[model samples]
Target: MKVNELFKEELKVINMGLRSFADDVKSQDVPVLHVDWRPVAGGNKKLSSLLSKLKSK
Candidate 1:
């Protein structure tokens, strides 16, 4: 479909990591799914690697 089709569709948002943005969208009566998300291992490389290894088990 054309890019303009996106504008014609209903606006729904999956807002991750920012409640304020979801709130703003909800204020405009748009559907929003807010997710409380953060970077893996708090942006630490070592811990992220460790977690990734564990997930492979």
Candidate 2:
């Protein structure tokens, strides 16, 4: 298995947090999976604590 063989498949990217970067990659015709990301609980300590407790169930 040569390194060149690995590149035979089409390039793909998973863009997190920034949509503009993903859009730029798409401009080059490459496929991109965009994930909208934000700070957990919007930077609220209380809300984040509550959410974490809920997930423990």
Residue 42 error for model 2, in Å?
2.0
- For model 2, which pairs clash? none
Q: Taking the candidates one at a time, how many backbone clashes does each contain?
A: 0, 0
For 1-30, candidate 2 gives per-residue lDDT tens digits of: 766975998888999977999999999999
Candidate 2 ranges beyond 4 A from true positions: 1-6, 45-57
Q: Worst ten-residue run, lDDT, model 2?
A: 1-10
lDDT values for all models: 0.92, 0.90
Q: Provide TM-scores for the models.
A: 0.65, 0.54
Full-model lDDT, candidate 2 = 0.90
